[model samples]
Target: EEAGEHVLEVEVSLPELAELLGEELRLPAIRPRGREAVLSDVRRYRSIRRTGPESLRHFRRTFRTALRRQIAEGTYEPDRPVVVPRREDRRYRSWRIAEVPQSNAAVIYMMDVSGSMGTEQKEIVRIEAFWIDTWLRSQYRNIEVRYIVHDAAAREVDRHSFFHLRESGGTKISSAYELCSRIVEERYSPMEWNVYPFHFSDGDNWSGGDTRTCMELLREKLLPRVNVFCYGQVKSAYGSGQFKVDLDDELGDDGRVLTSEIPDREGILPSIRTFLGTGR
Candidate 1:
């Protein structure tokens, strides 16, 4: 009798998930633009050489070399099926330094943490942000994410606090945009980095004046500097849902601006497609 072995395994890769999302949404590849810089050096083993370290030895090539020599020299037996490699029969991998370009990106996520945005809405934003991060990372070699949460005031926070923290106040969308603009001007240069700003809210602002200010910031400050400005409106019971309407009326014709309404969990996928489908 022969013994049998059975095993089960599960593995997860973020790049694989990103590919799945891309297939599901039929997302297009992003076209990166900028001067090429040698940000990092990559080792590519593209050729087999006669000599290299033991760790870099090429097993198949060495075997083939040994077998060919044995057959030509009449040392190989067909029935025995044995191959022994001599010192000169050894083969190894050779690598060359590949310069990777400096195509970096920054994703600034701003969310409304006002009293009206409930836990359920925040959960939706969290789910959406995960997908967004996965897709953007796949498109760029290096990506950095910044999080901001706001009510009447806006402040930057760490990843954990961004999703979990809650606040009670009026919604002033402009404050978040102003902070985002300042961050871009201070740290990320549009000339070198692809900037993406994603804002999630319940379509509630403190006043029409603040809404105007937000539009001004988008038009004068953010639109020209960013690849695209994405606005996601998550529905809430207390929210009036007027901000999206205003945005459509004001900036709907602009190619650099995108807006989507996330009514619930079901809307997450479509919203992601809407935001990233342009491949900007």
Candidate 2:
């Protein structure tokens, strides 16, 4: 009662944050597609043996064995029913250790660094990316993340540069898609890896030709290989906001392709659900 230090320390783990995101957004657990390349050792107790530790003793089998022994020896009586298991009658469980397939994932994050995408838009992308990574990490045993940013052209960068690097130029959304396709082809094989590509942009493209190129890349190269292709259109004051509309009109019928319009930071959760709720 004398000590007045009443401070409580709170630490939120990545798994806990992932659980919160799933609960709030009603997200479905992702079902990995394609061959699971990773293997994990799993032990299953399926057979009974004669000797083992007491922890693994099979009581029913031991009693049955004792009763059979007594009956054979003519020591078991109907009036006075009792069963005592001898040391030789003890039964135990035996386990079979096997290698089972485990699913692994690769997440490729793409963002537009054009002049139109402002600080607020990047911040929204950063926050959304963090939550999405948290949820995906919880789902898969091994996960790899790659970052690509584009203005007039696209280039791969580290996590720090992906979010903070500033670029002032015209936007070409197709460049990022091309880079993503290359990365997927070289590193992540469709038969072995569950690939997820998430792209954030202001929905401002330099030309309709580039938009067409993006759609072509997605349909021919990206969509066929990935588990899901998610496009998040972060709102910007100078953005034309036409790319999402085009994606809706073109790829809406494909379940592997998803697009969400993030008007502001408040829309992050719903967008996440839209991207992941299908369990693909």
Candidate 3:
């Protein structure tokens, strides 16, 4: 039994990752909720005119024009009626640009960066986010991502900063929701884009008042404006982890808002399924 030892090596490519994520989560292929305007250059033989490249020359029209010209000009001798096509007799096809309406989507990711949310939680978020991105990217023609991080306050950050930054402060979960709502309002129009918002945290908050505020924002501004809003509560030894309970108790199976509890890396994929399987 090789000294009762075992090892496993795992390697995943982009396509494989997407497939695995979809399979594990049982995610439905998303149909983007809103319409996008697309410009397309369409080539058609809609019109024919007597001036084009040789490749586009209309043979029948050119021969007819040549014959008509010879007959009308009195150059058609009955014994030998000769007709030659001139450059002016050639015809060609043309094309035009048309505007098409397509569908698009955007993903907004937010996270709690208080001391309670440590390296392990962030790692889970990163891995789950990767798979989520893979699936959503495949679903929409054009997709965009925005990141926000919060400790006592929320700030916009790049993808790198969202995953790596650390802050030792009290948790203000509502701040993140406020900023996320503003971003959605300003940049992603619900009528024109399929908006998805995901937030991960250790379920800690400064106060129950703030949690109520977050709930209001979701029910009013966010739930009405996004295709789906997902929340993931990561377990932490230092956190009270009460925010998840509050959301579940308040929202109570609302389709627009989904919640998942991820205890660690092992729970990442399952949480993904719980959050996205509804196909919202």
Residue lDDT tens for model 2, 84-184: 78999899878887454478799999999988888899999999999989999877778999999999999999999999988999999899999999999
lDDT of each: 0.89, 0.87, 0.81
Which residue pairs show collisions in model 1? none
61-151: candidate 3 lDDT, tens digit per residue: 6777877887888886655545677777666654444332256778999999988888988999999999889887655557899999999
Q: Least accurate stretch of 10 residues (summed lDDT) in model 3?
A: 1-10
In the order shown, what is each candidate's alpha-carbon RMSD? 9.6, 13.7, 18.5
Which runs of model 1 end up more than 4 angstroms from their true locations?
1-9, 36-101
**Candidate 2 TM-score to native:** 0.75
Clash-forming residue pairs, model 3: none
Best-performing candidate as measured by lDDT? 1
Off by over 4 Å in 3: 1-13, 37-102
Model 1: per-residue Cα lDDT over 3-35, one tens digit each: 344232324358557878999999987766555
